[model samples]
Target chain A: MYWITVLVVAIMILSALAVLLLPNLLAAVAASSVVSLALSVVFVIIRAPDVAMTEAAVGAGLSGVILVLALRRLGLWGLGDDNHPRPGDSLQGSGDDA
Target chain B: MRNFTSLLFAGGLGFFLLVLAADLPVGAAPMVAGEGILGQGPEAVGAANLVTAVVLAYRGIDTLGELSILFAAAAGVGLILSGMRRRADQRPDPEGGFILLAAADLLFPLLVIVGLYIVLHGHLTPGGGFQGGVILAAAFFLPLLGRPGDSLNHAVVNWVEGLAGGAFVLIGLWALAVKGDFLAPMLGKGALGSLFSAGTLPLLYIAVGLKVGAEIAGLMSTLQETEAAEP
Candidate 1:
């Protein structure tokens, strides 16, 4: 049972990483949340409901919100109508000064 | 561009997972520790919850050390943010975006009450000092967002911390003085799984919770004051 749980968690973590590196920050955040929830489930199986609750609250709840907020702060999500050449262009230009 | 690296990473992880799965144990049972100290015995140490027993009885000193570590972290946050402060004459308008303000107001009270509930029932249920304390800290953040100018009075925080600290010490001392061992259950352990069980553990958790809440709140207020001062 423990091994199965571990295998499930490992798969979730790998999937999360795949989501993270797929060039979409929102997708990455969602993937990370899945990983956290999976780990929390594993914690519950191990009879640590308190730890599972904390993980779900901190890892899934707070972290997802924080990630979206940070993404917004960095100007990732915006009005869909704008024709702005992806903001990464200006960011790359700024990097050239270094 | 990033696909090749990601693919390699994924492959490596898969290989590692296979290796770990190959080494699985068949069936596991609940772990038992210190057969004489934990199981049926004369001096059962009074606390019913085994986790609480371990925390407050067998490893009281370790818990004390953990509390000290948290204290150090809170102090470090204060020190780091204090030196980077702007001149007092240049305080910015405390107002932030409207959404942040309204959301903070709505969440603060709920967080505080829930945090208190968690702390009070820690001995009976799953939560304890650290979790409850963090929840309390989160509650304080909302107010900081909604009203940056209205700073949490450091004096009140300090007083609460001092009183809690004092109570913790007093209880420990009482246990030592009466029972000849520090942190021995001074009060009645009560029925198993009851709210009033675990003797001093619940009270200790409450003190630790208040201290943690105050420290985190102070840190939030301090950081906000500094950031609000920033452009």
Candidate 2:
């Protein structure tokens, strides 16, 4: 039981970090889904089945789909697209100009 | 430097939280025994599931607020997507293969049944309206995964949403008339652990399930339509 809790918490932290570090928006979204899934598992271990179910369905499933849809609307399926610059890319140039 | 500061802040916050958590009870605090909703829920609300009792009976107004928030969000998504002009030159989205289409067709009814079962049995089980509603939305949206151009009937969705919302309100009004309080359970609390128990809790859950399902399915359909349209 203790080991399982440790594993889930570790995975949750790792996936959350991956969401921050992943360059591609879609990959980050996928990582965030993983984080949610891991968090649900933690919720289950802690005996909150209702919260776990909600986290799995909404936080992981629906939220991921909505985020991907938004990303698609922004035409950001891939990392190598020059047509749509990432959020931080334009800010880097502004810093240099100043 | 920014990374270092963020790390320091996160570590400090984590440490603070850990210290606070260590002082708290691990599970089911003794002070909370035989008090609040946990104590009075099953007896007063007569719901087999304490969570359902608290959500639909004790804090029903909060649930209503949550529903309104969801409705506003769905409306905003619809408004944003509807304003985008579709290009005439956009190509049609491709349909899925035979296996995918067949799987969707085969699984759709089963998904619907499971979703309904979850929604209807909410007062007796761990599953509830929110979870079941999402499942229903997924079931409705599954066909679009196979056939992108195929769309759900917006009229049906709107009617379901309207009727379910009205039913929820009417039931609350009925409770006000009978018990002199909003959302008070009207029907008698039947034998515990039975399907027919929990007075008005199941009915409210069903209404919530239908409304939530319709709203989410409508949102998905609108988003899918926007996606299929030309930029």
Task: Write down the DockQ of candidate 2.
Answer: 0.19
Give per-candidate clash totals: 0, 0
Tell me the tens digit of each residue's lDDT in model 1 across A6-79.
78789777967777577887788888888888888888888887787778766776557556544543447542
Best by lDDT: 2
**Chain A of model 2, TM-score against the native?**
0.78
The alpha-carbon deviation from the true structure for residue B9 of candidate 2, after best TM-score superposition, in angstroms, is: 4.5
Fraction of true contacts reproduced, model 1?
Answer: 0.10
Clashing pairs in 2: none
Q: In model 1, what lDDT does residue A74 have?
A: 46
Task: Give the per-residue lDDT digits (tens) of candidate 1, residues B2-23.
Answer: 9899989989999999998777
DockQ (Cα-based) per candidate? Answer: 0.13, 0.19
Best by DockQ: 2
